[model samples]
Target chain A: MLEAAGTPQEIEGRSLWRDARIRLFRNKAAVGSMIILGIITLMAIFAPMLSPFEYDQIDWGYIQEGPNWENGHIFGTDGNGRDLFIRILYGARVSLAVGLLATSVSLVIGVTYGAVAGYFGGKIDTIMMRFVDVLYSLPFMFFVIMLMVVFGRNIFLIFIALGAVEWLTMARIVRGQTLSIRRREFIEAAHATGVSNFKIIFRHVIPNVLGPVIVYMTLTIPQVILTESFLSFLGLGVQEPLTSWGVLISEGAKVIEASTWMLIYPATFLALTLFCFNFIGDGLRDALDPKDR
Target chain B: MNAIGKKKAVPILSVRDLKVHFTLSGTGLFGKERKLKAVDGINFDLFPGETLGIVGESGCGKSTLGRAILQLIPPTDGQVIWLGRDIVGAPHSAMQPLRRDLQIIFQDPLASLNPRMTIGEIIAEPLVTHKADLGKEEIKARVKRMMARVGLLPQMINRYPHEFSGGQCQRIGIARAMILEPKLIICDEPVSALDVSIQAQIVNLLQELQREFDLSLIFISHDLSIVRHICHRILVLYLGNVMELADRDSIYAAPKHPYTKALISAVPIPDPEIERNKERIVLTGDLPSPTNPPSGCVFRTRCPFAKDVCATDIPTVDTINDHHQVACHFHERM
Candidate 1:
């Protein structure tokens, strides 16, 4: 009876990560998304070594050729008859690069901006939040389009545009978290310790706010990736010779009747990429969440 | 104002007429700037190796005074003299070196320790910031030693704050404060968030640490019982004004101020016989707003002993004894 009583108590006292992993692993969609995302990351990382055909290599005679797995064109040919599989691999690299870089840039700027606003509070917070609101009200897509029009199509430009547009949400989330965190005794304790403002902000304030920032960052990546893809599809991102899932899908859509394989393969990859990101994000949302734990 | 030759003992920390006012902007149609006197001309002294308890209800500016003493919030008007140096108007750069000497242990143990930092990192933070010369091994050993001193197991040093209980977390906070070996520790309700049993343990721990280190402490709380237990002297505050300042036994045995009397009478004694025999003094109305405080004496609105003179002039602090002081017109007559 003693052993039986102790067993349930021990189970209840399990580690937070154990509980988080249980919930995350149980999410089939999230798990499936993880697998797909992992595979895409691996493909992107090892694209050069793995792909048989050169990404930039072209075949004029077989431009827009359909898939023939036996002939080694497993995902068919693109507009330049470049192996679609290789192109997709390279495109994965670009998408992941833009997504990660843009998210990071926004995270840095937004976290700093929001943390300051929330920690100081009062008029400073009001003024900073108003600025965020003003930015939020503006037509984000139109601004991105104008930037693209002015700067012309460049790979880095896409990252910049996405980062600039995506940071507002991150800033708002960080600010809200910081506002609540600043009220906590630890922050006040830090202040009372005579710790400098810089140290308090970086050491005490930033660490407490990281959980929410990380969760939001995970969610933000998919949005940024989607936006980059959309821009690329519109010919304002990842220009010629440098392909992306969006560029490939856009090319495939234009001549779907002649080469259905082009549309099918790129579209499938794009869908799978999105599905993976959303799934991993959901899994992370559950896993990292202190409340759920 | 005479020097009062007895005051030359040189208080470790002296605060004179400390005032912290926040300007509240008007919200609606007719906006007016209203100044909220959080800490209104409060004066007190903390001697070396003595625990000074500042007790008041929430929003009475006890916490604000603690912060103002540390210069965490720039006081609107006041002089916070620590070791003869006025820290109130000191530059941030000038105060950096002094920070290591003056540390604080906050009320909520869980909220006070950085949740993201491991126990070792949290304790070692001050050392790293102030004494950067210490090697990694020395820092680790020091943190481990401090943790052991605080009665926590060495292996638990890698764990985050959330993993520990409230009492244990408070111990971590104490460890963090004491690791610096600060001259003055401002404990802002350190044990108020713990269980009754835990409160005793923390209070005992603080007393032990105080005696062991010969440290001066500013113990701020609303619990009169706990304050009486740990403090050498107690300063009763009402609406950002000092109502009474006396030795622990004197204040508890014969509180001169009406506010102090009301506060002591309200603390429920655990023993049924003693509790039944004790006269309960309940003040009639709610505490007046500090934004628009009573004209002369802040406590006049709540005082049962209030008379015409109580409203016209703020009573000065009259010496009842060498160390005891009471700010009430009737204290002399009584």
Candidate 2:
């Protein structure tokens, strides 16, 4: 009644989504992480124009040099005389691209699959969810490495591989959400109004469940990035000139005694990026939780 | 829309022996299913432009019957014949057009509306669904008009349901139901969730709208006074069985069955003197569980005048008067 009796202009209503956005922006940690993520993404995009040298540009003289700003090699040179700073920037592109693309793939597949399962309960839900449970029981990383071995280290395939494995959790999350949402009276009201199941699923059901899906998405992106790095460490990720943070870190690990900058720089950036994503995800979970409202 | 006003004698909805039984999840290993007969073999007819109130206690299955008649919940057995078409077991796809005509207003107003949609969108949803060719302007105009009719401000159409009070949200729910111009709108305890003061407002609004739209309503409620005020005919149910079905005056004045007598007696008289003098028939035992209802008669376990015959012999509904019916073997003596 407090809101109902308010003046018209004062009750200028905000939707659940807009309200969640306002709350998310209020959190300092989430906002700070977002800014760092933005900067890193921008650096990844403008790596070629900003860097003094190409990712693989070899200079035999300055090999294994410490980070010195004098020769325009801000992060010094790698063991193979390539500019480390530009390689790290290039690594950001590969890592972030893999993260986003893999997550996108999972989002599309998982949302559709879960919506179908949850909307049509009983036998269909049991079968669909049992399929997910079976997939969950499989050794995930082992399968990803197997796919890479079978497909010959294709970077695009890595996106598909990681996405394929990652969607099990997403499906489970979306399905659980959909199961609860499908029973809501609004859904019944929609059903009673002769709205087709398809419309009900995509328009009414999905929009409501998006809060959890979105929070889960933020969490999944960082996980996907870390998984890509692990694959690269195992020599199964982006090969050769196509460098990721994982590849850089593994290479750095080999000659850490000689030049610690390679290991230190990539690892620091990777850790910071993951930490920021986690913080933002936590903030989103808190903000979007219906219980909090 | 086709049969809105064509016939006067024929009932808009004829539900014959309708039953809705929910099977509980199986126990331990063998998983023997147990059936809870929520609405067990109930029959009723709803004519156009008349309000039929179903009054019962908490576990009387009144809500289940409403949903079963609307086909919102699938019935375990029997016919829900709407305009000669038996829609008891019709598939969801086939029920699409029929859904437009047979709409429902839920008990919880806010929960029954999509939290994400604006009030305007929620009201316009039925129109958009049933009349797909309606122009955006036309839909908006109709929504604004409906909102105005429901005593809600048309200017606040953009506000969400959360911003609205309980009564306002019920107004929104009513608007949604009335927008489609349905032949029948089942009010499933629409005012039960509102404040007592607000309940009268909603009830009066519904009465006004019913006249304005020539709408048939199956108003389900447990409040006897509210039912007596608005309902033309009241059906008294006890544990899924109709004890009495009569016009408001007849049911209130000379209730035949023991259960109806108890229910009507419980309604408090406004005058203190009459209220003090009134005889209240307070039943002793708790309502028998639906899963294990007493043999022959559902209300026998709680009926004060329960004899040996009441337990073994099922009482058939006997027509007591022109418009009064009672399903009690010992009604004449009572």
| Tens-digit lDDT track of model 1 for B30-74 | 989899999888888878788899999999999888888888888
Displacement of residue A269 (Cα, Å) in model 2 is: 0.5
Relative to the true interface, what fraction of contacts does candidate 2 keep? 0.60
Q: For model 2, what is the alpha-carbon lDDT of residue A57? A: 92
Instruction: Estimate the TM-score of every prediction.
Output: 0.89, 0.96
lDDT of 2 by residue, B1-334 (tens): 2222323457888888888899997889998888898988877777788788999989889989988887878999999999999998898777988988888999999999899999989999989888999999999889987888889887788889998999999999999988988889999999989999999999999989888888888999999989988888888888888889887788888899999999889889889999999899999979888987899878888889999998999899898876788999899987
Query: Which residue pairs come into collision in candidate 1?
Result: A186-B111, A186-B112
Which segments of candidate 2 are over 4 A away from where they belong? A1-12, B1-8
lDDT (tens digit, per residue) of candidate 2 on A54-173 = 898998889989898888889988989899999999999999999999999999999999988998989999999999989888897788867876878799989988898888888888
RMSD of 2: 3.1
DockQ by candidate, in order: 0.33, 0.48
